[model samples]
Target: MSKRMNSGASQQFVIIGSGQAGGWAARTLREGGFEGRIVIVGEESHPPYERPPLSKAVLTAQKPAESCYLWSKEKLGELNIDAVQGNRATAIHRDRREVELADGSRVPYDRLLIATGARPRRLNCPGADLPGVHYLRTIEDSERIRGSLSKGGRLLVVGGGWIGLEVAASAVSMGVPVTLVEATDRLCGRSLPESLGRFFMDLHLRHGVDIQLNANLTRLEGNGRVERAVFGNGEAIEIATAVVGIGVVPNTELAADCGLPLENGIVVNESACTADPCIFAAGDVASQPSSWLNGRVRFESWKNAQDHGVLAASAMLGGDALTRDIPWFWSDQYDVNFQLLGVPSVGNQVYQKGDTSSGRFTQYFVQANRLTAVAAVNSPRDLRDAKRSMQNKSQFDTTGLVPVLTL
Candidate 1:
């Protein structure tokens, strides 16, 4: 067993939360030649694993939990990291530079990385606590959902975001009937553009997934288990399993308890450094400055988490490396792979070419005649070229660029 240290021991590096960000930070620190005492504290019993697979592959039993690992326990131990898993960090005693765990043990550190990720937001409606009500976040959650989805059951998905859409696609592929409900008029309302959102709606519709927009859930009705859902319009639908993918709430209690100023997330600079010199943050729980968005933005994507983790580790080790990577995100629904490069804003002039109906199309969002972002549907090579163009700050020739991309 890894020895637990006292509160007032010599200052070393301590990472809270063993998610992607924390795992990468620890590895990056070692790679950057930091041979000091390192401690990783996690509330989850399992080691760090890829989270994007949870909604699709793992939830549908296409992949196993071991395949999602960023680093196995043996690998982490080989790196000489003292891992304390299955225990939650109760509080942060900033005055003493110590972190209090649920088991009354404390770990002191000179530098701390709060990679404590987010949790799924729960619905306040009635019957939400039923047996069939599930939320996807951890591997265990995905396992439970996979078991519930066996033999093709009727699933009521309550959200229109990436997770909900991905799960809907997975369930439909497994021959399950999925009815997705969203409170908004369009899917991915907060992320994708309205036109793109409608395109996705059509895509899902073509895949035989029932989608309901502008529909608010009043309550989930069941007999000791989630069996049906009631909408705001008094419409009811019978369902065997209910999965909530509304969104996630950042786990910022530890940071907040230490008096860290949080706006949307733990406020961090371009280098992922927090307000205190001894503390830093990264991944979904960090609201850091973005060169692409021209402001501070919090991105909840695998790319951001992994990249920011490296940047955070570099900053913690007295290296200068600000995250300049343009935000990129991808989603797989049925046969289509949707990829987006750069930040898509409202003012961009939308340009379209090729057959979107055939699922081979790309949308170029140009702001002031300069390509700001590009959305691709099953067009990987074109998306790569578009990303390279953005990296080079090249303006798009709307007349020929679109046709060339299609070629």
Candidate 2:
């Protein structure tokens, strides 16, 4: 048990895990006119920062890591939010409404928010513990990748998802020989359609990125540092470093320990409230109920996390508004910006509106005669309109979409 801080009659609100969701919740709470003592606990040394730039812009030397912060230190001070950085929350006592930190300290709160977020999944095999193998999920990881790429080194990337593909693009642009391996037959098999995946395969191959589909890694071979990777198909590739981008696992241990409803993440109602009214969970760590998608879904996107933060804060302030914003996600790869709007899984039919070969197009995923999702590549105009339509649940004639784009 940790020592509890005496809040001294002040209405204290403690938020666990100060990443994107935590930062947004703190800001929203103050903005919502809750003049409570807002305390945000984060495990990272730095304040809450954006993660999308870690693999693309920051790794490619296109942007600085400092530019990714959601709020400045001075801004946080002005908001009167206490940011407890470099400290991990070990447990949550729901009965007492207190949070325990790793350093044997506890903070009592009138209300609590869980925004612990997710962590990158790691490869577990021989030489997996090697020092040179890296995963990009934080600013430190991006800085290390940028430093390694500066040497023009040979890089082996595991997984063919958005993170792996984006990092491979950056490495190749830096004149680094890169090989990307995926267990699936195509890149982004879970997120993208086969046509788009094939297009990405060709695009990466044309850009000098060696992409190996349906390739599985057996083990990582090295002395103390990663030197080579052995594929399950009896093929071995020599490389100076390897990056593993095999998705993320939600940090739901705390919620689970506290006996909160958890499926893929911390389960919450449509209002982002847990079984306990005083406690709320949001962001990637939250399996929130979405009326837009007609189900409870956990989204691991930057925008979704921020939106959940705002919604959860509003709910805590006795606001009953429901969040109907269609889930949106974006990724930047090789000078191409890809944006996805709405729930792609709900789409039954897909229509491509522009030339995919030119890498500027929009693919609409339609379900039950309604547009359910839209994936736009280098087409921000379509992406914005698609988001608006999804939010309004507007029905569009598939045949007339291309003409609308022209106008």
TM-score of each: 0.94, 0.93
Residue 76's lDDT in candidate 1: 82
**Cα lDDT tens digits for candidate 2, 36-155:** 699999999988777887887788777888788888999989898998999999999988889999999999988899999999998888888787789988899999877866765689
How would you encode candidate 1's per-residue C-alpha lDDT over 1-407 as one tens digit per residue?
02222232344899998888998988888767777888999988887777988888887788898778898778988888888989999998988999999999999988899999899999899889999899999999999988888835699999999999999998998899989999989999889888789889998898888899989899998887788899888899989998899999999888998999899999998778898988999999998888788788889998889899999888887777654688889999889899988878867778886777788999998877678888899898888888888888876788854432220
Total clashing pairs in model 1: 0
Off by over 4 Å in 2: 1-9, 400-407
lDDT of 2 at 272: 86
TM-score of 2: 0.93
Model 1 Cα shift for residue 140 (angstroms): 0.4
Candidate 1 lDDT at 127 equals 89
Q: How far is 380's C-alpha from truth in model 2 (Å)?
A: 1.6
> Deviation in angstroms for 28 in model 1?
0.3
Candidate models: Cα lDDT each: 0.86, 0.84
